[model samples]
Target: MYLFLVLSLHTLWVAVSIAMQHGHYDMCKTQTKSDEGIVWEYMACQPESRDMTPYLKVKLEPPNSTCGDPPEPFCAMGNPYMCNNECDASTKELAHPPELMFDSEGRNPSTFWQSVTWKNYPAPLQINVTLSWGKTIELTQNIAITFESGRPEKMILEKSLDYGLTWQPYQFYAADCLDAFRMEPKSVKDLTSSTVLDIICTEEYSTGYATHTKTISFEIKDRFAIFAGPRLHNMASLYSQLDTTKNLRDFFTVTDLRIRLLKPATGATFVDERNLERYFYAISDIKIHGRCKCNLHANSCTFTNNRLACDCEHNTTGQDCERCKKNYQGQAWSPGSYLTIPKGTANICVSSMPSNCYCYGHSNRCTYIEVVNTAVCVGCRHNTHGQQCEKCKKGFHRNGSAKLDDVNVCIANICDNELLRCQNGGVCHNNMRCLCPSGYTGILCEKQKCEDTGSCSSKSGQESVSHNLYLITMIIVTRLCTF
Candidate 1:
């Protein structure tokens, strides 16, 4: 089996075929996650080294047509693509760390590697990818990512929601639905680590497949390192754009590294420093699997500096906005964009990162961007500002840099008596206090909470500001419960 990691950072269209794909499956394991948004994670997965072609082809075809005219596209099953132990260790050195890498000093001690085969139905097209190896393999399950490339043409993805029994057309994260998607081979934690991913594809109804796989994405990283030799480590963080309307495309780059043992410092007893020179390697691959709605060739999107972007004027995903469906932004969805992580990996077995909050230093403010589900962002309770909800919101005309934070503003009405409600979201001034709405927060809850802050108008001059606030507060409270 051959392994290839593809990361698209620039120039979207690309196709590469190399003879030497030998990599690894090896020895130790380390994984770590921090409270900060940044995390250092490491793991080792072992492969079963068993032939998975039979099960790989194991498919659950869609049910009989339920409607008079099902739709514009359809899917069909064909012969299985066989994997007759194509793995060769001789070329395995290719699997070794590249001459230049970082973090990991060119040593991958994991177990087996996994392979992926994609057939675009009827029988004319196919794409195959391989998985890298590490010290201690960590996953054991069927996995696959629903990704596609080629210029911005209206591309469609489909998948079987019921474990491949029936298929459905997929709509991307909604950013014109042309961005890529993926799924890693999944395996039961206690189950055997040796397993292959199962994916069903069809060119006849590719449009349908695109839809079917709408809810899928592959591992951005796993146990293997595509770039070796001087490669290795656990450090990756997620960051979005300041504006929702920018272009972004994935890109991967390997770096060179050098490790040296240290010897203890004279004054700092515990701080040790030594002498040992080791090479480091890294492999960064960006793969584009979601087809483009533009119908242009695949390599059109790419990244510049560190930003992903697309070729289209407003083509949400690709080089300019290759991250179409859901490009990360300080604000959730300034334009039309949104998304989520897979439910399959929600448990500790996988992991869940905290929702981002725009609260800094207890900025008691509450604001929601378009589709910025509250569940995805955790904010300060009393007062705070900025992301992380750590600052105080503007309230009751309070001025001076001495901003109120986690302040006991709204005692009974909206704060849940937690002494810290409406931090940076927005607020309602009442009885020498601020009735902070879950939405409106900040010091005074004056920052129109939602993307489009509702006008807190007093009912046609009836002094119903209190009443209007009552309605808005109720509306906001109910919304939070549902999430």
Candidate 2:
């Protein structure tokens, strides 16, 4: 019986492990058979979601927002008579430091980060709590801020995409949304597929002060449910939408978050100016769940040198695998796609080859040049020539309105020093046309102004004679040099 039970347990563990990796992109490439024998088949991938609080750096604005700088006393919100709590920066046990907000909580008396009391009543006791990751991350779960004191009556949760260069509101919390932010309150459930990106103010977490109700949240899963179904069982549908929509994908991406504490919870309609110590902010914990934004080109992220970065794959590089590696620019770089379900498109960058060249479909043959140690496209079609047939040959210019692969991308020059040479002392202007002299006319200045009206004077005749002499001398010199 013991041996049978152990076998069953081992089987169950394997099943559980498989389930855990079901939809998560834990593999970046797999070996597969092809015409060239065994080869690697890459696929779009991303890291698994995890608790991100431990990887963040927290900062408090106003520089001295945390309490206990000068040792202060504070009363409880429920009972003003209980004035036993003290905050002293010098004493570790009595001090309420910022790090306590992220510390593990299960102690008999939970540790917390507390702000100074609202001593100056009628003036707002404001604080800004900023959390930075120094890298882009995509939200995978709700952001919960557990307040040791009563939930703040007015606060704004903001996010930054460009590393704190700018910020936009993620959510607003207040007892009266209209009064605080001039907007009607709406819950995440009210959002739909068409309005999933709307930023709304919520009054749900800022109501009457209930002792058990201390957590305020910004709902991320609820917004995702607008497309992924209520239980998130239709993740393929969600992934499809994210793959096609750029704005929707960026909605969950952030580099930093800031909690703007505009007003503390004043239980009553009016503040009790007589006992202002009862009004202050205290937070016990903050929870953030996310994954590093790897542009779907990596399956793992690592923390190094006090910073988080994605372990890039598919011949890609950068903090987020945002560009193709050097020598792998045979094609323009593109982010991996989540379409085609299950194993999405890898969009892998192709390496530059010394033979069997890649010339953007403009050339089929190439020469292995020894000097450059690279392939040069030979006899490129479409009037294109270069190492990779990416440039227009001489006497031709690129058509700005045409794509690089289009045959019309390289148009013949209206005037050039070769076959289409400008005459009558005209010069080529940007290779588009000839800037003719005052006495010249026609596209290439081949016709004189007097010839247009059929008026030939002695002076015009003399000019024509000189022009013929010049052409003959050039032809004689060209023949002698050729021989």
Candidate 3:
């Protein structure tokens, strides 16, 4: 029993290790031993790929696009005489809603969302299935749509990045690519790295009405293979390309996806005017696998309050972790890099405090100067102030006894125009001292000198003096000079 348990645990460990390797950026931070002790080391991270359909809000245009508003009878796609299928919106068993397209499958007879039959033929029966996540997402797998009736003869998959404000065609599908979209037919397998982003019409999925060929897909992995190689064993190459190429990265990112069904499948060359019931769009399932677009700053996305949001890390806060948090803008906001493979650059937002701004420990805050294209240290401590807190401020001197990074490296001035001004007609000399006149004495020349013996005796007789007067003065002077 002990041996069996050990084997089971080993098997579980292997499975977990494989999963971690598959999703390398699943963790945002890790603890490691350093000279300063265990500290959090951050890296580029992203949420795990998951079924994104459940998080989507599906909408069909033309409001009344669904079938069975008034009970309707539909026939099978292969036979026009088989017209026994009755659809009634009022009946629960026969009703088909849009939500059925995303529902779980595996039932004997699949449930589907059927559009109103092409009763108004030659008008072009078109339906738009818009799946909105309301938040940005990055696709990691193929988008597959299964049809219960038949795969549409002409369809177009589109993506929107600005929450549906604009749209662009992702791929086109048609029985005749040149006729439908006016583009040459190109399969994903035929694409190279240079042509990966090119949108082309594919006849692969739209050609047949066979029962087994009911699924139409937008190929994501095939495109990824152009750079990653077949089987995707070298994902680092793909990641490197994606990191450096903004267009490629944007290709996989979307806030919304739209499936435009332009034409229904007819078993033959022409549509039968008599059996219009069999010529409707019916979708059983749509599988979308993706992760939230967190700018590589987060490893988890949560659905809350009926919306999806990334659980941001690396001092980032946004729906997609697109910007830095309020107090962490020491540097300009940037997306993390996937280049230095395994543990990519986090590009974490540094704290606004001067000491955390990479100012060589002299300051915690820094300000990005857009004009100069640089970050200058702000409120530098230890009398330091410069772009990197590497220079001594005016009226201060560099300590000869300490290193540049030392806390006491920038020595305070003995006398300056500000708080350390000279007095009693004394002249300031190079911020190191106040050169006193003959009658005055002290560091800032603030004291009056009793030069004559008679005046000194009278002053001494009038006021009682501490026995350790010299020692006290020296201690005060030392304290004033120290940081």
Winner by TM-score: 3
* Candidate 3 residue-wise lDDT, 412-449, digit = tens: 77777655566668898877788999876767766556
Instruction: Show model 3 residue runs off by greater than 4 Å.
Output: 1-23, 356-365, 377-483
Candidate 2 shows a clash count of: 0
The per-prediction CA RMSD against the true structure, in angstroms, equals 28.2, 10.2, 7.3
Sorted by TM-score (best first), the order is: 3, 2, 1
lDDT of each: 0.26, 0.86, 0.86
Model 1 ranges off by over 4 Å: 1-21, 24-48, 52-162, 166-358, 361-379, 383-386, 390-483
Residues 111-139 of candidate 1 have per-residue lDDT tens digits of 22211111122221211122221111112
Residues 1-483, candidate 2: write the lDDT tens digits.
999999999998786455332346666899999999999999888999999999999999988988899999999877876888898999998989999999999975899999999998788899999999999999999999999899999999999999999999999999999999999999999999999999999999996667579999999989888887898877777888898999998999999999999999988789888888898999999999999999989999999999999999998999999988876655566899887677778898766443433687787655544456566766788889887778998868988899887889898667656645678788988887889999887676766888767798878878776876776666567558645
Least accurate stretch of 10 residues (summed lDDT) in model 1? 339-348
lDDT, candidate 2, equals: 0.86
Count clashing residue pairs per candidate.
208, 0, 8
What is the lDDT, from 0 to 100, of the residue 152 in candidate 2? 94
